[model samples]
Target chain A: MSFAQPRYDGTSLALGQQSDEELMLAYAAGDLQAFCQLYEQHKNPLWRFFVRRGMATECAEELVQEVWQRVITSAPGYQPSARFTTWLYQIARNLLADQHRKAHRRFTLVSDESEALESMASQDYPDTITEQGRLALRLKHCLGKLPALQLDVFLLKEEAGLTMEQVATIMGAGLDACKSRWRYAVANLSKCIGMGAPADD
Target chain B: MTEEEKRLSALYQSLDKENSPEHVDARILAMAKQGALVHTVPLDVKQPSRWTAWRWPLSSVVSAALLVGILFFTTSPLLPPEEQAVSASSYDMVPSAPKQARREYQAMPEQKRQLAQSIEREAAAARSKTASVLPAAQISERLAEVDRLVASGELQQAGTLLMSLVEEAPEAKARLSEGQLALLQEALHRRSTNQ
Candidate 1:
């Protein structure tokens, strides 16, 4: 990301209250306990992050494995220059971009809003499908309909639980641009999912 | 955040229940364990090989010896000039340093040449300290003459010449090697005994 990265001041958190950066540093210094704890904390969020980006379950699993492998291999070189999540998501983002390039399936913005709505309308729901299942399916469809960049912003914010600044840092976009993309994603998804009309910008 | 945004976030949270499969978890955990084991063992708790155990002390001893050898070869007078040069050249030939260090070490031959030159200059300076008063050959000739004069029974003349030699080159006695001084003393003793 070309955005200005946050700097870590030398001041440390209190003992027994290590931040993600501390855990990473400990892991780098060969503390397996720290790494195990770190893996436990972020595994689900990272998994969901790949999954929500429309990766197949098998593909997402492979990517998850690959990301951890990268983290392990790169541990020796890791600096506490930015938040660990920002760094983690940045790796995930790069891998995702590489996968897209390899597959020649770079996600483009949906050309027609009606096509997304029509796709939603044509889906045949089983009689046994719960309301939650239907909503999740609709949400997945709307997410797919979004521009690749917008979906990235939304997933980073909602799935990774990153702030706008962290998202900007990870995405290499300006903070204002990140916020705008996030708003657009939310508005589009809100309208597509019939969540009581899209909120006014 | 707006009410609509909150609702969307809540909706997503409700549906975001997908966990990574147990097999994937096992695989990732296994990877992390392997990685941590590698990281810890290579640095924090590594078992040293035989070479690794000896590397530091051996390198230290070698470095100290090299430094002492360079100092002695460049400054010591007991070693002949040719031997000093040979020692300097031999030290230069040691291929112990790394590539970058060897690149720096490549300049060492020139430095050793300069050191050899400086040593030669010091030897010349010491020789000139004695030769400034009188030629070494003339001093030897005078000593031989004193011995001949003693044998010829010209004791007064031999004593006078020996005294003149001392007065003319007062510092010569200090500069002369032990063997040369012993020869001078023996001639003086012969002259005294003859007297």
Candidate 2:
């Protein structure tokens, strides 16, 4: 999930062009257009962040709704002290943690490597499904197999476009710990997808 | 990140195109619109002008001043029609009396001053015909006793003292401010109702 640069168009060119922090401040000051532009920019990546973390589609939608509702209700107290994405993902991460605490089931890996590969091979790949397509499905299963902390680090770093430091802040871990988790996530995911160890090592 | 990590990131992106459902977007946007409506004041826009900002405080001050003026005027001692002439003259004779009357006399228009002078002459002539009454100081002491009686709930004694003060000194009520007179009357009324 790429955090795309905001695209400006129509009458909202000025507001749409603002940095996320500025847009949030405008939203806090009661600008609906600014909020709408912000929501459009982030809604998908935010939803995908939860979806890729093994949350059910309905649960993901519900979390997305809750996260935005918190953003709206808490807008008045928003300060431009940090990047808006950091604040947004912090909310999402906290909500996900809360959901996990309540369910106690999200941490269980849904498939093993044998099951994933077996399922992948058994499902007749459509003619148009490229070599990369099979691996993408397999990699997703590999993500489920990652330690909860490593997956959280990897997902926040990659999916939310946060820097290692920002990811550390959101995950409440040290920068080096987050980097190690990311590297481990990458190596683990690579092995699951048959890419083996990082060639650079 | 190494080449392998880059490639894996690319693969992940390929599968990451899922969006929140359309219904969710509609519900959230509608909520945002409704929220904006409730928060009518935009902090960044429509700054209040100096006058606009000051209007409420200024109006409050003016209202307070008007309230004080109304209370002062309504509660001031009011002389009956007969005493008005004598009171106007007596205001000059008693230098220790409330300075408010003298200040009012000075502030009065020329026509009102002329009327006060004519009334003063009539009062001076009538002064020779009637007996001199209790001084304002003595009347004030008696009024204070009435207050103490009312405070002690000795309304029966307070009423007798009040009637005697009125009978003995016809000018006593004129000396009592409207607020003091109203309180004395209330105490007397309470005594009669209790019987």
Candidate 3:
């Protein structure tokens, strides 16, 4: 189920008006309003990250709430040495890692079965979707075919817009290794989508 | 650039076409407000200090020390009267009658008092022995062990050991002596520069 639509007056009094780091610092100083703004800005993109990663829609929804809760709990002591999104997805990566470890031991991976189920459940859609939406969906499906590490690198780079160095830091790998993962991810996605890469962009 | 590199670059552009959802701004603000309220409510009830984070463990240790001290003091009378007087008088003077009364009080439960005193004496002896045996040389030796770990390319292990030393050290010098800190700094500098 979708979350209730957040109400916003035109006034922009919430954290949406501020930079992520500014909002985080404000939240640290005991401003709950700042956290709400930060959450509002991140929730959908964060949810989509999990959704495109082929998590079950229900699982993605639950995980999105849990990630926000963690952000709220940690806001008081946050020290932003990097972009707020980088710090956030670092937490998300860790949670996803734990979930993968548990899931690996419990289930065989032929495909992300839960994600396939969610896609099947959403089949009653109009054919008049925007071109961008169609392309994004196609890309998402192709992304699911890559190895887990490559997919993670690709998503962090493309969706989160982290530099390769920052992605390396988050992945706990040397820079070259992260770059290689990204290269592999992109090649695999292009091939799977039958685009074989756009000629000269 | 190679075809692979070109492909990757194009893929990156394709991926960048997506935008963050419109609702994210509102959700983050709401959550921020809730978080601020949670933090403020607790402070209203009790003003927390920077050190309150350490209070649970500190208070736990203090409570344990007080408990042990009480046990030691109460069981002193169960020892031979001479030892009791020596230990008690070393700390404070009480009336001779009160001392005798303490003996009589403990005599009614001699076995329990004897068992407790035996345990207390053993604990006290163990603590004293530990204090006496911990030499500066032993601390230096531990630092040397950390250096060896660092030399072996086990930086993570070395870092963990160094962190524990910093935490447990009585003073800055004691926690990470000048030599050890210098060594650690050198290693970190080397790694960062090399990278």
Candidate 4:
């Protein structure tokens, strides 16, 4: 599922190293190559975010595609007011909320753990196993058990590699509130995975 | 913030690559390329030059001026002041067709009006001169023909004939026999009352 980046060839070479905001500004100014670069950068993280957002049992691919489509449609008016990933994720969140409303589902903070367990259980593991792989599997189980909001905060930060302020902007909350959410999400996830709460104790 | 949090974040990332599906990627990339090609395509709608941008407002102003010029010429004092005043005043009211025709008639020039009246008078005089006093035999024969038409039940035709005889006005009917005159009058009365 990895979308190998389009070769940074010819006209795209100069824009390849530009920051996400710079690339977005260029895309807004009718540079599609810059958009391709941004797309190459974000497509995976965005897809994973959709899959792990606890609604992958639904049309995760379709939702991910829709997120990219929105990115394309909204390119003309895009502003560099915040990080491009923040704006992109914010668009993703809005689409997610739209899907929720369309399904007549309430906005609750509980991940459906059974679906996550069933998906993991279907994958027969190889006899060869690494310690890190085992830990990741255990963490995935804990993620399903995490309350929906904490998992959301944790996943957004991890998936986008976003700063607290950027996460706050995407979540429509103050930075302090975002930090508080992130801290609680981390502590609870650590406890669930039997990782023992951090040195903050 | 914490080593534990970094480890947790790292574990989360390692579970799966889980990139967008191939169909999804292909679909989105195709769209992105299509959009790029669209923008890169040669455009029929050229970028507006400074003058081109102003063309609409300038054309609008020119059109408004031309309309004003036409209005001013039509209402100017070069035409008869009284006629202009009357038209301008009437234009302020919502007039019907009859009123508009009446206004035009009232606004006719005095010379034109006198010529029209003279023509009408001459036409009436010619009509009167054409109506000669008929011999008694001819009058009696015409009355007999009217009687035949009335007998045949062609009341409308009989009425038309009666109207032509009376075209010179009511006194002209005095030439007919009393019975024929009574029959013509009755036919005319029935047609008129029915209408």
Q: Report the candidate with higher lDDT, 3 versus 4.
A: 4
**Which residue pairs show backbone clashes in model 1?**
none
Q: Which runs in model 3 stand beyond 4 Å of their true positions?
A: A1-17, A105-137, A197-201, B1-32, B42-195
Task: Report the lDDT tens digits of candidate 2 across residue range B105-161.
Answer: 778898987797777777767775454477778878998898798799886677678
RMSD of 4: 24.9
lDDT string for model 4 (B1-195, tens) is 679777777777678777677778788889887766654555587788999899999999999999999999997687587556544544543264388766775677978755655665577678777765555566566666777987998766776776666663445577676766776778778878989
Q: Which of 1 and 2 is the better model by TM-score?
A: 1
The TM-score values for the models, in the order shown, are 0.56, 0.55, 0.46, 0.53
Q: Per-residue CA lDDT of candidate 1, range A97-171, in tens?
A: 999999998566545464565466456778798877777778877776677888889888888899999999999
The 10 consecutive residues of candidate 1 chain A with the worst lDDT sum are A1-10
lDDT of 4 by residue, A1-201 (tens): 122223222354477677787776666566777888888899888887877756663488878877887877776656566666777899888887888889897644434443443344344546588867766776776666565556667878888888777787788888887787788777766655556642121
Ordered from best to worst TM-score, the candidate numbers read: 1, 2, 4, 3
Q: State the DockQ, from 0 to 1, for candidate 2.
A: 0.47
Question: How good is model 2 by TM-score?
Answer: 0.55
Query: Per-residue lDDT tens digits of candidate 2, residues A1-201?
Result: 234443323245487468887787677767788899999899988988888877788899889999999999888877666778888999999998899888885553323343553343344546787788888777787776666777888788778888898898888888888888788778767776677742111
Rank candidates by lDDT, best first: 2, 1, 4, 3
Instruction: Report, for every candidate in turn, its global Cα lDDT versus the true structure.
Output: 0.76, 0.77, 0.64, 0.70
Instruction: Considering only chain B, report the TM-score of model 2.
Output: 0.28
Whichever of 2 and 3 has more lDDT, that candidate is: 2
- Name the weakest run of 10 consecutive residues (lDDT summed) in model 1 chain B: B175-184
- lDDT of candidate 2 vs native? 0.77
For model 2 chain B, where is the 10-residue window of minimal lDDT?
Answer: B85-94
Q: Please state the CAPRI-style docking class of candidate 1.
A: acceptable
